[model samples]
Target: MAVGEEQKRSPREQKMLLADSNGQNMTALFSPRFKSAAAMAGWDEEALLLASLVVEDTPDRDSKHKRRFVLHSKTPPTNSSRKRRSQRTPQPVAILDLDEEETPRKDSGRKKKGKKISEGSKVEEGGNELTEKNPGVSSSSSVLPCIDKLREELSCAICLEICYEPSTTPCGHSFCRKCLRSAADKCGKRCPKCRQLISNGRSCTVNTVLWNTIQLLFPQEIEARKAAGILNGRQQAQNLSPESAFYATLMNRSTPPSGEASGRISRRNVATTTSRTQEDEDAALARRLQREIDEQSPGTTTRSRVHNARMRARGGISTSQHEDAALALRLQREEFMQTYRGSQEHVSSRLPSSTLARANLRSMASRAMNLRISDRRR
Candidate 1:
């Protein structure tokens, strides 16, 4: 169907079902179904920036659109930060009350002696503070990290490092799906703050901003972690932070290396234990895979359809168990030979006709020759 027709369809028609962790099935809404009731179709970044600037400057929605906004700032707006907390009162830019052509003549010496100075000082001190807000969107933190800035800085948003299976929320909040899921456990699948119900799991896209941030800030750290097979949970990452290390070193009178973190914490963060335990799990996985490979019948098994249909159609076909087994063995041997051939090539390139190379080459050539002889005999 065309994209337009697809859009008009019910979200239910496009929903996909998948098994959740509990082994029960559930429906997930997909993105692209969002209906924009207010904003124009083409919300270019330049437009958004301009809107942000307008919000920065004007700070107030016209009274007519008041109810439509989730939170509206009531104070006057400005292009700058207001008075510091230490100051007596906040000052906002006064409304431009002059005509466009007016130019007040400067009279420095005479005015320096007048009550006009006191009047001007009082007027400036009494100006109201400017507050900016998102219309129909509740303010969380007024000075939020900009989305572009986030994309530019972080390598990963959800993990707050490099992204892995990141899922965005409806309100544009994001977490690694697993991380978000973890955070959701502390609250729910919905965002902890917005509470917007994300219907489709797939449509929740990546937060390019957060991902970029991690890449910029910790490129080498990320590479080392990936190389060392390390995956950090939020807690572990938090504990490794500068503030935590600072306090720790100060309290101990010496900096403890991250490797020297408490054993209990390390054990809790990483699932691996002694090397012996890892070997045991490796053995178990090997056995499981072997059993799985064996459980599936060879292509020649009964009820399978590897037999040539065209030969049967031509009424020129006859088959036997010996022929089937020979074919299967030939294929399997070819696969084994191919694997050994790669290893042989690598060994040859790395060594000058080394003993290992000679042995592997001989073994592969012998298998190939035997297979060819067997095929000739057949």
Candidate 2:
């Protein structure tokens, strides 16, 4: 029936049918599907040769028109074509004779296929083994050791633990705020690591950057450290004696009746109180010494004597006071000599004979001279 339909066609109609068939054949030849089919069939050389012949036989205008039509119909759009081109393996340029290329091409294709299969299998086995061995391996697990190291770096030197409520000193060292505060209270305002002067922990600011990083990396550890600190504080509070606890409560009070918002006494106030007490004691001692001096020298007034005694005690005696001291010493020496002479006279009177009296007087005079010499030396 198809042959009868062809025979019944007019001459012009027959020419049109032939042209249409030719056009269709040309489109197929140039299409990507035809090229891929030829490559898969291992007929690259034959396909190229056939394409060359057809291209040579077709007129330039008809070939161009047909190629355009084939591209528009059978080929993908530009974007899709680019994507396919990227995905497609590049074909090597054929330079050798067909006979020479055939064996090598077949062998190479087989070798490539075998290598791809082996490599794919090896990769699948490796992935499966990893999954089986370490099912928990993930981004978080991988970062754990790094986080631990960072925790060590951010730990307090005093407490030897991760810092809780991290604070920074002037010397650029960081520590747990509670640890630093306790150290400052016990050992003065000094850094534990560097032994440099630091502000008290109460005055020190939190290291915001280091604190944030520590919080991000070790939230649970920070929470644990904080909890431990709270427990320790509670334990210490419980251990305190009632009197000590009461004193501590008084010291910590923010608002006391005494107009001082800081309930604790300042160093300046303590020093001033000490000095005032010392001055009062010194004045009392001066008054006692002046009373003794006044009793020895009846002419001096109490006020002048007290002032003089105080000045003398302070190593700033005047010329007049020095003369008065010398006169007092002279008077004491005279009185001693008179008493010694009177005692010697009484002892001589008690003797029975002139010879014994003379001997006793000589002995007593020697003794008195010796005592006088000793007193002068003193």
Candidate 3:
């Protein structure tokens, strides 16, 4: 069958021929039966490929075209006829005068200003102090709800307290600098609030503008917190042991012993000293931890060296063991030599000096000499 004959076939017959074979003919050109059928029907690779796509698209395309055809056939004509208007009598137009005011009894601007002044005077002197609100002015103390809202905004999510040395994440969440550092180092570099990736930067800075605003708005709260922190710190310091106190003292002293002789340190000096002390203490702690780690995980060579040193100290495999071994070998060699000489003397005395006897004695001597040499070597 040629392509022209295939195209000439009725639509019903073509659908029947192209009906799906349970997806078995999906590789039409690969399968021998389908390939022969396609070749007989005058299809090339390009035509087969194009036909495959067409077959896959046919159902959707046919349904869409059918819908469009039905709509086009059934739809009413849009060329509507124009309607004609009937002639009617004209209505008279009335114009109102703009000379007179619409509201004749309205108060003048001067009267309004006078009334506002009178109201202000009444509030100042005649009105009850609490009830009347000053027209344009509001006291901060009265706006407690607004203050509370602002405090909430300033509070750190990690601590649930007002942010001290506040650090802002890329995700727009804010936390205290110390709290953020601890979380990033221990938990993860991802943000806790929004779980966005956070940069690992050395500097954990406070938002200065936010800090100043918070300080101004909540001065009392900030002062109270500072006082509480100081008290707690003093208590903890007092609780520390003598050893800890000694280290703390060493850390705190930034200058030489001679500098301590000068009396009356200022508050600024004390704060500076404490900050320096913290840095020193942190450095000392890191060094101590590193030392402990090195000691715990000593290298193979170091471990072997230590083991050998201990063995030497305990007299294990010493010079005395070596001396005892040498003495035992000397005694064994002497005993063997004495036994061999006795055997040789006995054999010589027992045998006569005749030709047969001499031969026998010679053989016995040779055997004894060989045995003695072997025993001495052992």
Which is the better candidate, 2 or 3, if ranked by TM-score?
A: 3
Write candidate 2's Cα lDDT for 98-124 as tens digits. 446798888987786677556545544
Best by the TM-score measure: 1
The TM-scores of all predictions, comma-separated, are 0.29, 0.25, 0.27
Name the weakest run of 10 consecutive residues (lDDT summed) in model 2. 88-97
* Better lDDT candidate (2, 3): 2
CA RMSD per model (angstroms):
28.1, 39.6, 39.0
Off by over 4 Å in 1: 1-165, 181-188, 192-195, 202-204, 208-213, 228-362, 365-369
Show where candidate 2 strays beyond 4 Å.
1-145, 229-378
> Among these predicted structures, which one has the highest lDDT?
2
How does candidate 2 fare on TM-score? 0.25
- The per-residue C-alpha lDDT of model 1 at residue 341 equals 52
lDDT of 3 by residue, 1-378 (tens): 797565445543533344434134456536788788878998786667667857765654565457558788466433421110011111110011222342332445456556655544443343234335664533332244455676678898888888877888877788888788888988888788888888863467888756655555555466677768755764576478543432343223322231321221332354557544544444444345333323322232575347445546768673454344335434533443344345446547753112232233344345445543543343
- lDDT on C-alpha atoms for all candidate structures: 0.41, 0.54, 0.51
